[model samples]
Target: MIYENDISYEIRGAIYSVYNNIGPGLLESIYESALDYELKKLGLKTKRQVVLPFHYCGDQLGSFRLDLLVNDKVIVEVKSVAELLPVHHKQLISYLKLSNFRLGILVNFNVNNINEGIFRKVNGL
Candidate 1:
């Protein structure tokens, strides 16, 4: 698995591409699609809107879809909100724990600079 700084660098590169070209005020899917392209251009495998099922006790609880899953190792959540909330970060953390993925990226594309809006999340699970 990659460390925080390395993964952060990968994310920053993606954010830089998206911000420099795409700008903001687009739909989450638009940003997601753009990120997918940029990450793919970097030669990283990426899956968009991946559905992850949650199990409770012994029964199936529900499922949540991640905006993007990169290299089958990192979860990427795209948002076009006015500002990122704690709940947004918490949601990514929960997704990381649920999917047993070690790292995740929460990116808000509603800002002028996506670099500032990019956050790295991790779960030991």
Candidate 2:
């Protein structure tokens, strides 16, 4: 899998800007929308709430939605929980695995510092 550090840094910075503007405890949608705006402002291609289909053992397992997908290569998950639990990271990892994306961002907009809320490489980190 290709790991683009320069692009990753741009994505993280955009996510951080959104977190800084809309401090803590907002709904996931709020953060999702704000991040979408910021990412677009940075000229990075992104998609929001993309519905990805899944299958189980050749059977259709239905579809799953992602909060934000950046550059069609990274998944960005927004959370407003008090702390980013393991399950949150698991969800993002699952999304990357299921959607066949190589990487993801598990950004929890509930910490004192936005940097603390950023979890990079949800699928590999």
Instruction: Choose the strongest candidate by lDDT.
Output: 1
Report the number of backbone clashes for model 2.
0
- Residue lDDT tens for model 1, 6-51: 6557767987888789788989988888988998888777899899
Candidate 1, lDDT over the whole model: 0.85
Q: Score each candidate by Cα lDDT.
A: 0.85, 0.81
Best by TM-score: 1
Kindly report which residue stretches of model 2 are placed more than 4 angstroms away from their true locations once superposed: 1-3, 122-125
**Predicted candidate 2 versus true structure: per-residue lDDT over 1-125, tens digit per residue:** 43556558888888778776768888888888988899889888889989988888988879999988888888888888887778888888888888777778788888888878888764553
